[model samples]
Target: MTEEIIIAGFGGQGVLSMGKILAYSGIMQDQEVSWMPSYGPEMRGGTANVTVIISDNRISSPVLKKFDTAIILNQQSMDKFESDVKPGGTLLYDPNGITSHPERKDINIFKIPGAALAAEMGNPKTFNMIVLGAFLKVKPIVAIENVKKGLEKSLPERHHKLIPLNIEAIQKGMVNVESVNSI
Candidate 1:
């Protein structure tokens, strides 16, 4: 099986990091993976996006026009990638900064309150992990153990102490995701 995913958000929202972690998790599961990131010059508050592909077989390229999943974190992303989801695919989003909601009926749409959850957890940095957890809940592609390992690998040693908190955020997201529409 192959899953093509586009994760898009404003810079500093951990969009690239989420894709990287997901790619690493896929690698830990012995799958072919590709992670390509794009962002504007202004780093923070600028548009950022990453495309990740995970497959059981060979991956020919990292570039893609459409995706099996689109994980959106902001209004700009919702506007940009909502229509790029393949028919019958999945679209997971965090309803934090969205002004217009998704309206597609062909694909599945799920929303997670990542920002609010992160704030409640008293660490807004775990917002990405929470969204990742919601995505995993909808599509159980990689193992949780691998995700833990990926988190450990992606974060620096100095930040290693926050692993448990991130895990907790993931669990919180897993249980809090709400289905907007499913097909």
Candidate 2:
């Protein structure tokens, strides 16, 4: 099986890191994966995006014109990637940053209040993990055990203490995501 995903958000929202962790998790699962990131010069406040592909077999290319899933964190990304999702694909978004809702009849749409939830948890940095958790719950493309291992691999040793908190945020996301619509 192969899943092509695009995650887009404002910089400093952990967009790249989220994709990295997902890629690492795929690796831990013995799956072939590729992660590609794009960002503006402003970084922290500018837009950033990452494309990740996980496959059971060898990956042919990292670039993709369409995605199986699109995780959009802001209005701009929602506008840009909404049409990029393939028919019957999944579209996950954070409602806090969205001005308009997605309109699609062929794909599934879900909403995860990542930013708001992270703030409620008293750690804004966990927003991405929350979104990741929601994605995993909806797709189950990678195991949670592998995700924990991926977090260990992705985070520096000094930050290991925060792993549990991050995991908790992910769990919250899994439970909190709202199913907006389904095909």
Candidate 3:
């Protein structure tokens, strides 16, 4: 199985981190993985995006023009990457500051209110985990146990205490992800 994905959002939304976690999860699952990120200096408020590819066989390159899945966190990203999703692919987004929504009928569109859900969990940092969880639910490309291990590997020991919370946030995402459009 091969999944090429692009995750985009404003900086400070954990776009790169989420991609890294997903990459690590792929590693734990013994899959070939590639992760690449791009961001401006004004990361906190600027745009940030990452490309992650996971496959059962060898990976030729990290660069890609289209993706099988897109995780969009902000309106700008939604505008930018929505068209990049391949026909019959998945476009999962967080509908927080979005003024425009995905309109493509060829790809499947899913929404996870990560920001609001994170706020409801009383910890905004878990927003990315929630989003990741929604992605897992939709794809299940990587196992949850591997994802937990991936979290352990990505986070420093000092923050290991938050893994359980992150897992909870992921579960919330799994339950809350709503199908916006599917074709």
List lDDT for all candidates, in order: 0.91, 0.93, 0.93
Candidate 2 error regions (>4 Å):
39-45
> Model 3: number of clashes?
0
lDDT of 2 at 60: 86
Total backbone collisions for each predicted model: 0, 0, 0
Clash count for candidate 1 is 0
Better of 1 and 3 by TM-score: 3
Residue 18 C-alpha lDDT in model 3 = 94
lDDT of 2 by residue, 1-183 (tens): 999999998888999999999999999999999998864453465789999999999998787879999999999889889999999999999998578889998999999999899989998989999999999999999999999999999899999999999899989999999899988
Taking all chains together, each candidate's TM-score versus the true structure is 0.94, 0.95, 0.95
Model 1 compared with the native: what TM-score? 0.94
TM-score of 3: 0.95
Off by over 4 Å in 1: 39-45
Q: Which residue pairs overlap in candidate 1's backbone?
A: none
